[model samples]
Target: MSLTDVIEGTRQATAADPANAQVSFSVANTLVPGTATAVEVRVRDHRFAVDEPAPLGGTDTAANPVEYALAALGSCQVITYQFWAAKLGIPLEQVKVTVDGDLDLHGFFGFADTRPGFTDVRITVELAGPADAADYEKLKQQVDEHCPVLDLFRNPTPTSTTLAQLTG
Candidate 1:
């Protein structure tokens, strides 16, 4: 089965049952022992480490959380471009995304009033295909409107935190 077919099938199924369109994802993480800022993350069957660079007091074992966020945005943009191109019947031979984000450590350290997250992010999408510029522009518009990670970055999401105690 082609990706177009799969995309259309999913669209039809979701249209028939709106509940099918709503889904949730989850991941688990634990702080690595004897590390200042290293964590082990579990997503389904996959496992990876997340840590800051040496300058941030971590052992520089892996990409930091902010880097992961940028990666998520870039990867999501690529996926959205492919799916939108297929759904719109636009020929997409290749797609590449580049993401960059700016952060200020003063916020994390509480030394200043700056926000503790990315203040600005930039994304560049390189597309290669037979489609004309207009078609590509249309695809870009659709992707900008539909990409989940982009939405997460553009809009504020309500979040809550709870404290749990573990006893041995």
Candidate 2:
């Protein structure tokens, strides 16, 4: 769709149901322990797999959990770039995001008090557009403020896990 279409859609949605501006998403994972490192991931009506690389222990069948996390961040950034560019009147012809995370082996192996999550992450946003640098900067600032995944990473969101028995 064109940027104008997206802008109009967003405007209509927000105007019709402001509450929808705030939303929630759900995801589920079921272990497929039959494989060395694979899990059935369910998000809405879609089903996929998440796995670890061979070096870490499992077959290099799918992206590992950490990689998925980084991908999530990158995906969210991509979404925000387009969404905000449309909203803020920035012209973006093309956009690409490259994300990387640094992790310490000791943290994952329980050898140290280091963080089990990414020690840090870097994301490079490459763009091809007619907008000037200042316009790009303005759009980026808006994206930084609006991106949900970016907010989740930059700020602390309290999360609790619950375990329950499932009977089939």
Candidate 3:
């Protein structure tokens, strides 16, 4: 089956039942002992490590969480561009996305009043296709409006945290 068919089928299903559009995703993370800042993360069947650099007191065994955040944004942008271009019939040949973010350590360390997370993020999308500039621009607009990760970065989401304790 084609991507368009899949997309259309999803649209139809969600339209038929709004519950079909409601979905949740989750990941589990555990701090690795004997490490300054290392986390084991599991998403479904996949597993990965997240660690900080030496400057942050970690052994630099893997990419940090912030780096993964940037990667997520970049990869999502690429996927959104491909999907939107196909749906819009823009004749896309290639899509590449670059993402960068600025962060301040003061907030994380509680040394000053600053945001601990990324203050700003920038994305650049490169496309190689026969489509005109206006068409590509339109495609970008559609992607900006539709991409889920972009929305997550652009807007604030309601979140909550709870602590659970276990005794051995």
Each candidate: RMSD: 0.9, 1.9, 1.0
Best-fitting candidate, measured by lDDT? Answer: 1
What are the TM-scores, per candidate, against the unseen true structure?
A: 0.97, 0.89, 0.96
How accurate locally is residue 57 in candidate 2, as Cα lDDT from 0 to 100? 81
> What ordering of candidates by TM-score runs from best to worst?
1, 3, 2
Candidate 1 TM-score, true structure as reference:
0.97
What would the per-residue lDDT of candidate 3 be over residues 46-79, giving only the tens digit for each residue?
9999999999999899999999999998999998
| Alpha-carbon local distance difference test for all models | 0.95, 0.87, 0.92
Which one wins by lDDT: 1 or 3? 1
Q: After aligning candidate 1 to the native by TM-score, how far in Å is the CA of 25 from where it should be? A: 0.5
Model 2, clash count?
A: 0
